[model samples]
Target: MSNNLFKDLVSSVEQAGVEVNHEALQVAKDKLAMKSIIIRVISILGSLLGLGLFIGFIALAASDIFQEAIAFILMGVLFLGGAFALNRSNDGAITVSIAVSLYIIGYAFLSYGLSNDGHLMGYSMFVIALITLFLYNNHIISFLSSLSILVAIHFIMFDLDIQTFYYIYLAIVLAATTYLFWQEQRLRTMDNLIGHRYLPIFAALFTYTLVTGIISSTQQFGYYYFSEFRGVRLFFITVLVAALLFTVHLVLDKMKVSKLPIQIATYLLVIIFNVLVAYYYPAFGIACLFILWGFMRQFKAGFAVGIATLVWAMGMFYYDLGVSLLAKSISLMIVGAMFLAIYYLIQKKGEKHDNI
Candidate 1:
């Protein structure tokens, strides 16, 4: 269908007196569609290896100059400059691979230089990532830098033993996740630096969101460090549920769900029900958010993830209860049936929409 759509688009343009070299376009597409995922993974591993080697070399330098904070900062800046220059060279994979290594190593030096101060280290890394977004435009580097920003934020909160602003951080993540996916096309088509970096940022945001969701569910770092703010968990659930609802609204609008009065009534009912469900099982709501995105974008991976997350969260929820096995079995059956019914309705709606 997508191939057909592309051909139809080219045909329409040709009819409008536009010249399109489809043979050349097909060649380019074929080249781009090569199996690059494994290559990318290897490239990333190579960069990490390079970073490790650089650290080891720096440690064994055995020079007082190497021990100074300014020395590390200078080295980081130098490496970052090299990376930026390499990126601008229109080089092939080898050059970009080397640039990625240098970029990681550069940030490592910066981190070590500011190791004495947590706030300085985290904020400086964030600033460096921001600068890199404008200077280096490669996919791997952009993704790594976006991840660096998230690492910086968490490092500040966790390293400094301050969990007060966890809710604020959560809010930022949710808001960014919603906005990035919602405005994806606009950002991708932009005629500036942002367009080049949007996909990387979008991917990074989802990676961050899913990782944090796991951490939250597992009662791990977020739980250990921020347990004192247990009350704020409710705030998290509220905010997340709101995000889910807002996203649903956007999706329903696109689906042309119903007339205004009917849509408003449906929204009210959903809110009422979700409020109760979220209070007891917030992870379920989180999973539903992913499911919504999965459906909206025809994203099979995200949809699978959402379903897996849903099963895991519900299993946990049931595990936590002290109810009898019979009660649990019944409960699972009920929810499972409800989900199937909803899925059936959605499938019917999709078929109808397609026919229309």
Candidate 2:
């Protein structure tokens, strides 16, 4: 009788375990179904939001102010609503998309006001829009916000002096760029993927500066008819600078040079270039020679040689020496030889240090 009771107890325990397993499986299935439903709902909402924005754009283009305003308001509401919903749902993409949509709507409203001769209202709208955009950690939105602010300042605040406006823009851009660079550096140190992604952005910015500088110089000094054509020259210069900088960075990486040295060389070169461009004096060439000497002392042979070549070329082009063209060519050759000798000496020292 006791043996019969033990068998019955074991059977009961096994049955209970099977029941528990079945319940757990059902719970998992329910959770998965809930997730699927949420995903579908978010997708539908996104589609609707996109459709609404498209209709709003059409209304705007038709110059139906009432319709446009209504559409924009609707768009903003939809995005804000979606963002709120997604935050609760723990859907990152939904949250980000909605936030971006809100920013776009704000920008559109600001633009409309500005174009319609409502400068005060436009400026107010833009300021509000920038604040909203800044709350979101999206780079695209941030850049657009900055650009909108710049445009508003340029067009609406016409009373400000051009130089003042230029300086303000420069300061803003520089601050933003420095922040981004610092972020990139931090991410790189942490081995994050985002660290490398900003390279193209930096390249693009440098290109823009180069292109704009060229166009403005050409238009002001080269007697261009319209300011519109200025951008083309600026664009080419931007391309050239981007290409050169990219190459330099690439080579430095391959050579396993420390980033500090590369950065220092870049800074020195930039300062020398700026001084030369600003002064347009023969003495700048002498200053460049001294800068090159400093770089050589720091074991930046490649950079020193590159700067020396640049100075020599610029001098030859700008200075109309009483001497013949042959004399200029001979002088440049001598300068080139000097650079080669210096580079060789530095290379030998570096080699010896490595050997030891």
Candidate 3:
């Protein structure tokens, strides 16, 4: 087995009391490494090209069926069934690539077929996503299906105009995602399939939750025009803020921050940032949420995402600010100064931990 995989196996065995079959792991890794990484990547890319061509041919051949919703539904079911069957023996990256294309195309067909019936489409998506989670164990499929479920709920609630319930749903998602990430070890080592699929699901949850925060912050800043449910959107954003604070609590605990005064001060700065972001800096609160979670988890990719989000949020703040250039500069300077001060404090705390 490769070094990282070997280490992961060791951690799983030690921390979670999971059994590791060393001989089987080595055989599996050797099989996977039979081809060079570049060849596997090229094969997947070539498969994508083939799938695209196939889709194009199907589109042209079935042009007449596009007008009939029933035809679309039938074709969608057929495609989904094909993908599921293909994935039953899905081994290579090339096979997975093709199956994934078919799966997405299946959903696209269903979406178009049920375009006019928003409620029906939402329900179908939810059911299908749940079914796909069980029937298709691929990481990409799980991630996409999880996102579909979220989008389906939002669509259903939006269609019904249940503003309050929609926000409640978002809160529930936030809570669930928080719990999932907190219990990552258990989930990732529960069993074979669960272990294989945990990361993608967590990734989907984190991504959707963070992106929602970004959009909500933008809407609050008058970037997106909401016809109604403005207050409810604010409530949703508040839930994100609460999630951020919860992540901050986790990070402080991780850093062994025991001083009550320091904790209180850190939270105070977060609140101040929240207030400022509510008024001027779009997505800043969400960016900080990313940063805190990245710190808590020591996830470098999430950290990179947080940095990118912070930069984008600042750009949006400047571009969307209607005030004079001088005013914009002043506002940005204040945000920058506060951001740096908080970062410095966090850095110092981290250094203190390392010294200990």
What C-alpha lDDT does candidate 2 achieve relative to the native structure?
Answer: 0.45
What tens-digit string does per-residue lDDT give for candidate 1 at 1-356?
24456669989999999999754675465356345656756876787797788667867886777878998998888888988888877546667777888888888887778666655888788888887877776787888888888878887787677666565576578778888888876776577875667767877888887766656655334355354565666677667767877876876676667567756755554555455444445556667788888988878888899889888867765775445677566556655654663475488677988999
Q: What order do candidates take by TM-score, descending?
A: 1, 3, 2
Q: Stretches of candidate 1 above 4 Å error?
A: 1-35, 54-58, 61-66, 159-161, 225-231, 249-282, 321-338, 349-356
Clashing pairs in 1: none
RMSD of 1: 6.2
lDDT of each: 0.71, 0.45, 0.70
Weakest 10 consecutive residues of candidate 3 by summed lDDT: 219-228
Q: What does candidate 3's lDDT look like per residue over 1-356, in tens digits?
A: 33455567687786887777654664465455544546655665676587668867977998876678888788788888888887766556677677777788787786667665655778878888888887886666888888988888877876776644555565577777877877776665576655666666777878887676567546353443243556665665677677777877877776677799978877776776665554344357657766777767667778889788888777776776465787667656666765775577579786888999
Structure candidate 3, residue pairs in collision = none
Distance (Å) between predicted and true CA of 135, model 3? 1.1
Q: What alpha-carbon RMSD in Å does predicted model 2 have with respect to the real structure?
A: 16.7
Q: Record all residue pairs in model 2 with backbone atoms less than 3 Å apart, i.e. clashing.
A: 207-238, 211-234
Cα misplacement distance, residue 213 of candidate 1 (Å):
1.8
> Model 2 over residues 1-356: C-alpha lDDT tens digits?
23245447656878887433433433354355445655545754685588567866876787665545455555555654454344334434445455555556545654454444454654755565557443533443444555555555544544332332332343344334434543543544343433423433443333333233233333233232122444433433333333334434543443456658645665444443433342222222322333343353342543454365456445644464534676556545544554563465458567868999
Q: What's the distance in Å from true for residue 170, model 3?
A: 3.6
Q: lDDT score, residue 76, model 2?
A: 53
